[model samples]
Target: MVFEAILYIAVLLISAKLLGELLYRINQPRIIGNVLAGIIVGPALFFLVQPIDAIELFISIGVFFLFFLIGLEEIDLPGLVRVMRGRIFAGSLAGFFIPFFAASFFGLSLDMNFIQAFAIGSVIGASSLGVAAKVLTDLGKLRSTIGLEIFTVTAIIEFIAIILTSVLIQINTSDAPNVSEFLWLFAKMGIFFAVAGLLAVFALPKVFRIIHSHLRAQQVYFGLVIGVILLVAYFAEISGIHGAIGALLLGIAVSRMNREEYLEISKNVNAVGYGIFIPMFFAGIGLHFTTKFVEIDLWIIAGFIGIIVGVKFIGSYIAVKIAKMRPATTVAYGVMSKGAVDLALMLSLLQVNMLDDSLFSLLVLGTLITMIISSVELQRKLKKIVQVKVGSVEIGMLPIFFRRTVSDKRAQDAMSIDFQKTKPNVSVKNFLNSDIDPKEETMVIDDDGRLIGIVSKKELNNVHKKSRDVALISDIMEKKFHTVIPQDYIFSVIQKMNSHHFEMIPVIEPGFSGKIVGIVSSKTLLNLLAETKPPNPSTKS
Candidate 1:
């Protein structure tokens, strides 16, 4: 059995990798292939793999780690606040409640008990962050209005999943429920949040700073944090919640630390996650579909698949439209993709017999189908988004895109250089002394007789003693290069200057195969601006 499990995991990953490569070629997400890999290796065709308790637990561990990473990435307090707003909350409520009620009605009509119906609803209502993240990323719309709407609504629904799970536990555990006994689970949940919240506000920031500052070595820090994550997870299980909840809370607390430090660590964590646990988790879900379950009744299977697959389309479409997503359809499609987490939820239900094998395999199939559609639609819509300016101001907080343009006057006057007009074959190094005549300026040239970099008399004296000889014009000459089309503007140059705090910048000639045809300076820009503007009415006193 153990050997089968290992073989099971190995074959599943290899399949995922091959499909992922194929998807990458078509400009589709690797994750799309991964989910489909699960379905194919699973019940859809191959009976090669089987769902076992151990396989399910590994998948669950993957889910916790995935969410822990998500929580760390989601440090936007203001964004979370926006998601928690009333409209989103309302949409999430409708999504969970309506689908749940619908699933329960079908279950009851089909002659299953209330508990079974609830389990069906739980399976249907869950969304996959891994699938959703990939879909949004592939669409290149993760920050789009629709993406936000999907994320917000889906995030809220996760809370509902937890609540629903708790309710099932209560129903299953209690023989004759008393109010006091019921209160225990809810009380435990409240305690979990209260403690997690307190740690977030106080203890965690200092703890994270200590780890980030002192733990300079990467593996030691990585091991320690993973240990903490698992420890929290184990305790969360002991504390009457899913282990994932503990990992999530741990992430939330850690994410609240100093952003720079947190971002650096997040970069490392993401690398490890994408490289290892994430793909393993996604592929492992496929191993659970044993194919024998497909012999179950067709309608019973479709009903299970329909509730899970169908609700995502309807719920995501309606919620996103109401949430004011610009192109509601595209957003809805992106949100429809299912992921490793959804499969994990299904397997969790299966592991505990909250869902039967047939239903689990069917829902997994739905996730698989929708993921294909999600990839196509997401990629199409993402190509339409132009880099638009939000307001009248040309300046973005940080220059995400640079349309390089420098005006000729500001470009020429700054460096005041005319390479063709100047004396040729003169090496600028002969005049590196600041004590030389101010009127005499040094021009630099590379071995190809093309200008590479320039050094001013003032700049030459400051060159370090060790860098004295080999620091040719190529070495000390302003290594940074900027370009100008004969018709560019001053404001653009200023923007670059603002970025690099450059007093002077080299300018390459338009359509010329030469090193910097000229240069530009801040003073030249100000002078040009002064020349263009109308003269001051009141002159000197």
Candidate 2:
């Protein structure tokens, strides 16, 4: 058994990586590859592996880590609170209810009982926040207004789905519905959240501070984080909620405190989750695929797929349109990209025997199809609509116009020539007294005219007031900063500038000379935007 487990893991990892790379090359989400890896290795194909107890345990841990990492990366509590408004709430309701009831009614037509149908409907109703986030992040729209609205809607949907799922689980376990059981489930859930919230607000901060101060080893610190995640998960399960919810809550809690430290530690967490565990969890789903669904009607399967895809798209479109949100098409597409929560719910139902293997496989197939279609479609559509321009170069249709702009317009085209340059040896007082624009950042150069560092006006102002003695420009200038070459694409440069929050970036000439050419600032970008018109709908490619 031990040897077999090793072989299973080896095959799973290799297949996952190979398929993931293949999908990535084809411009699809690598998650599709991970799921395909499971189907290839499991009973649907070779039957080379089985979902044994040990393997299942590893898969469960993988799922916990997957949700934990998602919460860490995606959920911005303060931001979400700030963005919550009537349109988002209305849009979320429309997105959630439309598919949910449509799927439920379709399940009933297929002769499923109330509990079974509702369970399946809940799975279909749940959207994949992770998938939508990935799509938005790849397209550089994660921070945009439409992106934030999508995120807000999905976060609310996931929370609602969790509550519905707990109800479903309770219904599945009981022989008949009882008032006490329903009340107890809700009570337990409420109590768990209240306690978790208190710990998050009051205790977790001090605990995390102590851990960071006392622990020197990265491994030990990471372990502590995982321990907290698992402990919360355990409490959540005992309190009759899903463990994934607990993990997500813990992630949000950690996110709210000490952002700088969390950012550093998140690298290690992402490495562990994506590098090993998350892929395994996805692959594990594919492993359960079976070819023994001959008794299940083909029409039922087709109808399920159609309903899942149709309702989500139309519902989101109508909702956003009625709410009068701008860029309605893009918002709809963003909402249509569902995440892994639906799959998680389906698996839960399967585990409890609320859903049969045949039905589970059908739902999984629907999910895989929608995920692939939505991701590809969203990527293609976003390229056509998202317009970014600098100077005379149009970057509205990226990758398509990428090469044209690269050859026609360089970083030098967008760079501001009217900027101050100074030697590192100059005193802060002397530099401030010189006739230079105080609003712009001062570039520090070596004796050879090569760009070395930069000092913002704010830093200079603080130094001027605090320092009893004179300080060199080198003493205050930031040494580590991003620099673009003159030959680089204007679009790529803009992306870097936006991501790093750099108001202005230094553009250096390529080759051994490495001389500072000029700088590109937000003012330059805004000028480009003013000159460029929106893409014409008739001319959209």
Best by TM-score: 2
Best of the candidates, lDDT = 2
- Clashing pairs for predicted structure model 2, backbone only: 128-338, 128-339
Candidate 2 residue lDDT tens string, 1-541: 8999988888887888889889878877788898899899888898877888766887788878877776777666676666467676767777778888998898888788888888877778777777777777887877765666677777776766756876788667877778888788778778887899789767987887888789898688779877888898888877778788788777777777676877865887788888988788878888887766656777876788887788878876876765555456666777777657777777778878888788888788888888887887777777675455432232233343444454456677777877878898888888778888756654545557788887777788788454614788888888887788877876677777766534778888777776887888766754544344444559855
Per-residue lDDT over 1-541 for candidate 1, one digit per residue giving the tens place of the 0 to 100 score: 8888888777776777888889878866676676667667775567566556665666666777876876676434456576675676666666666667777788888887777678767656655455566666765657754566667766666646655764675455556767786688778878987887687659767776677678778688777767777788888878877777677777777787777867866777777676656766776666555566679788877776676667667876776656544355666665555665556566666766766666666767776776666667666665653322211111111121122222233445445464221222333344353244554334334435445554554465577656655454444555444445334565565655555533555566666566555655554554444334222459653
Alpha-carbon lDDT, every model: 0.62, 0.75
Q: lDDT (0-100) at residue 123 of candidate 1?
A: 58
Candidate 2 lDDT: 0.75
**TM-score for each prediction?**
0.64, 0.71
Per-prediction backbone clash count: 0, 2
lDDT of 2 at 510: 79
Q: What is the C-alpha local distance difference test score of candidate 1?
A: 0.62
